[model samples]
Target chain A: MSRPAPRVVEFFSGPDDLSDQQREILRKMGERFPELTVDELPLDSDKARERGIPLAPGLVIDGVILGVGSVVSAGRIRRYLQPQQE
Target chain B: MTEAPKRIYLDHAATTPALPEVVDAMLPFLREEFANPSSIHAAGRAARQAVNLARSQVAGALGCPPEQIVFTSGGTESNVLALLGAAFAREESGGKGHIVTSAIEHPAVLGACRFLESRGHRVTHVRPNAQVCIEADAIIEAFAADTFLVSLMLVNNEVGTIQPVAEVARAARERGILTHCDGVQAVGKMPVNVESLGVDLLSFTGHKFGGPKGTGALFVREGTELRPIAAGGKQERGLRGGTENVAGIAGFGKACELAARDLEGNIDKVTRLRHRLIKLLDTASPGRLNGDPEQTVPHVANVCLVYVDALLLMLNLSQRGICISVGSACASGKLEPSYVLRAAGMSDFASFTSVRFSIGPSNTEDEVDEVVEQAAEMSALLRKVRTPEEIGQCDENCPCLWEERVA
Candidate 1:
């Protein structure tokens, strides 16, 4: 069976408050992972709160918390998304 | 796969890293030269000489006599002292009750004006042009028989727009209104001669250039009567009362000296790098440059990318190892959009989508190129997710819903 395309959702305090650095990182991740679908998770959404995501800007991959920090690079996010060998 | 390096730092306008020379100049004061400048002993005399020398250097840098320079804790304090001192002096002299300032001024001036307004002083905030430059005529028009002070910034911190301070000063002088300039961003970056500008008061901070933080100065032209804000020991000629920040002042003086020597060369270098970065971004992205390109400072560039979410873009850039800021660093921590941009007629979406890239001497052409490439890529990615409807609703067209979405 083919591997499913990685689904990633990035949560932010607000849509307009992204720093230039953060925006650049998201762009790189998009290029490196062509099959990955990136979505913006609203901070006030019940779904984001249920997942125990921190109040800071963060990213989640395939329903798993990936990273919680300002300006998370694509390489670091990919590490979290990579499938581990059994 | 190896991790990508952290994003490059391009936000020098917010605050610059202290230069190695400034650090070296401050080490002795921080460690061994721990004497009170006012003490009568040899150690005290030595400290006093250092302070005096630093003062003279700063004065020289500003093309004013050393006696005119009054050291303050930072730009905020300097701004307060300049505005309040002049306003109070005018009031004491039975002058007018009105104060005039530009809408594009740093919060330091605006806050001071607000405080004055609370105390029954009327303040008229002059709006800037679409290019973010404040007109001298607007300031003149705002002035009245009761107008005693006009506060304007030499260079706007957000958009890097240079104000017509000389003309404004000349106009204010004609009407006997004291003019104060917040030169925090302009000093050390450009040639600032108080005599030429003809302003009675000016404020500058060290960290904005390369000196230590918490150190700044205000130039009160000789014979300009002013009231003291801080009451204590007669430090800073009794205007500001506190133990002098000897080390920081020494470092600031050194920074000013170096800035004077390197101002032209640094401007040329940073301007070239900024142009190169802007050119690259223009070629690869649907980004519009904010502010007047011709009249802006060399080291700052404000760019607004359409369709891309500012927050997402910032996160992605951080992930890519490039460090840039959205709007002013002072306003970064706040969830609200930039007031400066809004005042300049930028829509909520443009203000939200805009990011400021302030370059410094430490930045390189290579870093600028890397940033531009990453920014272009990130903008493209964010744009992919934003539909045309979303883009249309980004600015003022859908303010009510947009606030709901953000809130």
Candidate 2:
């Protein structure tokens, strides 16, 4: 059977809305992982809080917080997934 | 990944990009000319000469003698040294010391005043009027019988209002009170002559005017005795100690020379840009200008946009490669609303949302237009989604709620 699509959750703080740059970063990551399943998580969400995410505009994959702030590079996101893939 | 966009920096009040000429002047000192300025060797003499020349350049820029200028790390150190040194110098002469200053002073001066108060010195902070300006008579009125020093800033860093330092300094001089002016924002941006300002001590830094960081100086009038802040060899005429920042000093001197070259022309150019920005921002957003337009320096324009969250706006602007500063600063790891605005009688909401846009000589009109356009468009979008607290319905905008949210 085919491997299940990797799940990527992008978090924003304060409000439910995502900024243009945040959406663009998410889009870039989706391009690399064609079958990527994206989820929006507000920083105040129980999942984000329980994981001890330091800040918003964060990326959570495989139940681990990877990064925060204005991240745009898909290559960096791919590298971030390396440990999780291993 | 695509290359980053060209950044449009509009925060000269915080710091300016060091000029290419200044960088060239500093590099030799940083590399081959590195030497302890105090050593008796030939190399030391060369460094000492460079430091002397730098002092003269700074002195020339301020229309003072080179001997009066004492180099320090930056504006903060210069301010603290001036305030504490003046306070202690008076106490050493068997007189209890007191200082009269304004409420909107930078934290450096405020911190120094608090330190003096802890050491048994008195400090009276005079509140500014609705125009965000301290009246000369008001400052003089606050002076106590034992008041030995009056410290005031030449310009309010956040609001850009030029203070009546010369008039107050003159009045204080007549009363035998020494005056120190925080000229960090005024010295290079405009004409700042110590004689004209009538200040016994004036603090200024290089980074505010196209020079390297970690370099600043304080002007102590001739025969004004100041107790040393540090214990070391007889550097800075025993007022400040330790080895001089040779490279930074060199860059600072070059910047001063260049800044003074065509002061009036530079002022006119920046003034035109400030007007253009104000007009554009006024049309695009419903907000009030925070400073006295007539009395302020033309570089910094602080505006308070109604219903828009400034931190959110700043994040959006940063994504577009436009750099601006907020009127409020991050204090103790959490950003706080402007105490400066509160002291100037602004409402809590206005203070929380005001943004400071400081223009430099290098900034072009097109750049100003682009930045303001982006700012206004983003702010409008942010206002729609902002919480009730951000729009002044609650106590204050909890900055941590969106502090880490960039873009």
Best by TM-score: 1
Please give the range of 10 consecutive residues that has the lowest summed lDDT in model 2 chain B: B398-407
lDDT of each: 0.80, 0.81
DockQ of 1: 0.08
RMSD of each: 7.7, 8.8
What TM-score quantifies how close candidate 2 is to the native fold? Answer: 0.82
lDDT of 1 by residue, A2-85 (tens): 765556555444454453455667777678766667676665677656554434465665544444434555555655455421
For every candidate, the chain B TM-score is: 0.93, 0.94
Cα lDDT of model 1 by residue, B267-290, tens digit: 899989999988988788776778
Binned by DockQ into CAPRI classes (incorrect, acceptable, medium, high), candidate 1 is incorrect
Question: What does candidate 1 score on TM?
Answer: 0.83
